[model samples]
Target: MKIGEVSGHASVPVETIRYYEKIGLLLKPDRDASDYRVYGNAHLNRLLFIKRCRNLDMTQDEIRELIRLSENPEADCHEVDALLARHLIHVRDRLSELANLETALQQLQQACSKTGTVEQCGIMGGLSSELGGLSDKDTDQRNHVPGTHKPGSH
Candidate 1:
């Protein structure tokens, strides 16, 4: 099949498939007589596996490692177990962080319950205090750090 055919069957975008090839996650497909990319069942299966791994929020490095381990069918499952355990811990940490973020947002929302001018807006005052590095001591410092980016950065 052609690249587009495989992409449609696998539900992965063509650009992503090309990127996977570039990143060494997916092998480059063979070309036809017209130099068009040709894909096969192996590519489709691999693409599906990669998509599943991505859906699990696994890092590219982790997916790569799993793929490497997958090549050796006789290898012990301990390494895979360890990797999953680590990922679970990371997921739990992110959940906790998200919960804290929600709480912080709730507190910020409650700062100004009534409608008013910007000058009298408590929410704006809290945000301004945060930007000025004068945030309340009770605020969650971990999630409140302002992110910085260079101009025109994605």
Candidate 2:
């Protein structure tokens, strides 16, 4: 099939396919007599694998490593386990960060429950204090520090 067909079937953009080829992630397809690229089942399968990895939030480098491992079926899977573990840690950390952000936003929302001028708004005051270079530790304990939260708990 052509690039467009492959992209549609794989649910990935054509540019992304081109980039994968450019970065040696995907092998370049053969060209037909008319100069159109000729892709095959191998390309389709590889593209789908790449798409699935991306959907799982795996980085490009990680995908590359996985592809390498796949090419060497005799290689031990310990490294693959390690890579997945690392990615899980990152995902857990991000989930914790997002939860903390939600809590902070909730607190900020409550700051000015009653409509008032800018001088009387607590949310604005907190934001301004942050922008003014006040240390996160120096701020009220109720205020959430963006990156200080632990994983798996709000």
Candidate 3:
């Protein structure tokens, strides 16, 4: 099969496959007489596994470790378990941070609920606060803060 065939069957983009190869995640495929890259079942299988791991939000390093462990069929899975537990903890911490962000946004919304013109808009006032860098005209700080609440549709 060709690289395109592997990409289509594995649901990974051609660019991503090339990047994996460059990053040493995927081995470079053999070339044919026409110099076109030729992939086999092993490449397809590996690409699919990597896609599944990415879908699960596993980092590249974690995926590499998993691949190394997979090569040792007789090895115990304790390291895999530990890695998953650590990922779970990171997820939980992010959730907590999001909750705090939600509360802050709610408070900001409440502060701006009063009817006012554009000149007296509460939401704008909160965004243009003294600490919001509006005085310095630095709007790049707008989305720099993580876990922000997007006040959309309401």
Candidate 4:
């Protein structure tokens, strides 16, 4: 099958497949005479797994670790259990941080009740020095800031 066919069957984008291959997550496919990528059942299965893991919000490092563990079929699954438990803790921490962010936003929003000029706005005041304007600590602890969301690049 061609790249497009594999992508459709796996429900993953072509660019994402290429990226995964580049990052050593997925193996590079064979090329046809025309230099078109030729994918096989293994590629399709790997892509499907990757897509599902991404949907679960798992990180690339986490996926890589999981894949490594999967390769040793006879290995105990205790490592996998520990990995998922750690991931769950991370998710819970993020949820708590997001709740704090939501409260901060709500308080900022409630600072102003009636529509008013910018000079008279409480919202503006909430952002001013007098109001101890928000200087939120960066909640995200990822290596990269994710400034631009390049597809499957993380």
Candidate 5:
């Protein structure tokens, strides 16, 4: 099969598949006589695995580590358990941060009673007020949501 075929079967974008290969998450497939990429069942299975991991919000590093561990069928499963536990902790933290964010936005929205002019917009005023600004700790807490791009990523 071709790249497009595999992508459709995996429900992943073609560019994402290429990116996974580039990042060493998915192994590069062999090329046909016309230099077009050729994919097989292995590629399809790997892409599906990657898609499932991504749907679970696992990071590339996490997926890579899981893949490595999977290669050794005889290896102990403790590492997988540990990795999932760590991921769950991160998910919980994000949920807490998101709840706080929702509360903050609600407060900001309540600052204004009704639709008004820009000058009378309480939400804007609250955002601009130095006294109402988020503290450094609050800012840090809000900034680390999952899937946020960090420095040095492509």
Candidate 6:
């Protein structure tokens, strides 16, 4: 099969396949007499694996490490477990951060629910106010000014 056919079968762009090859993520395919890149079942399988890893939100470096481990089938599986554990921790942290952001946005939305002039808007008032160096309980302490009540001082 040609590069286009392989990409079509994998449901990925031809440019992506070429980029994977360029980045050494995917092996370069053999060329025909006309120099058209030829692909085989092995390439297709590898592309599918890469796609699955991407869907799992694995980084390129993580995927590279996985591929290396896959090549060495005799290697212990404990390292793979550890890698996944680390990735899970990162995902959990991101989820917690997103939840906090959602809460803040909800509060902002509530502030805007009441009809008023722009200057009288609670959301704008909160944003524009100096807060007198006051900080929210949820605000990161690292950004808080010592003995200050300002919200945006950081």
Show where candidate 5 strays beyond 4 Å: 130-154
Each model's TM-score, in the order given? 0.83, 0.78, 0.75, 0.81, 0.86, 0.75
Prediction 3 TM-score vs. true: 0.75
Model 3, 108: alpha-carbon shift in Å? Answer: 2.9
**Candidate 5's C-alpha lDDT?**
0.82
How do the residues 68-116 of candidate 1 rate in per-residue lDDT, one tens digit apiece?
9999999999999988887777667666767876887888899996887
Of the pair 2 and 5, which is ahead by lDDT?
A: 2
- lDDT of model 6 at position 118: 91
Which regions of candidate 1 are displaced past 4 Å? Answer: 132-154
lDDT of 2: 0.82
As a TM-score, model 4 comes out at 0.81
Q: Backbone clashes per model, in order?
A: 0, 0, 0, 0, 0, 5
The global C-alpha lDDT for each of the candidates, from Candidate 1 onward, is: 0.81, 0.82, 0.76, 0.78, 0.82, 0.78
Best by lDDT: 2
RMSD of 6: 8.5
Looking at candidate 5, what is the lDDT of residue 139? 46
Cα lDDT tens digits, model 5, 1-154, are: 9999998888889999999999999999999999999999998998899899888888888899899999998999999999888788777766776897788789998899688798999988888994566575434342455333222221
Ordered by TM-score, highest first, the candidates read 5, 1, 4, 2, 3, 6
Clashing pairs in 5: none
Query: lDDT tens digits, residues 69-97, model 3?
Result: 88998989998898777667655755787
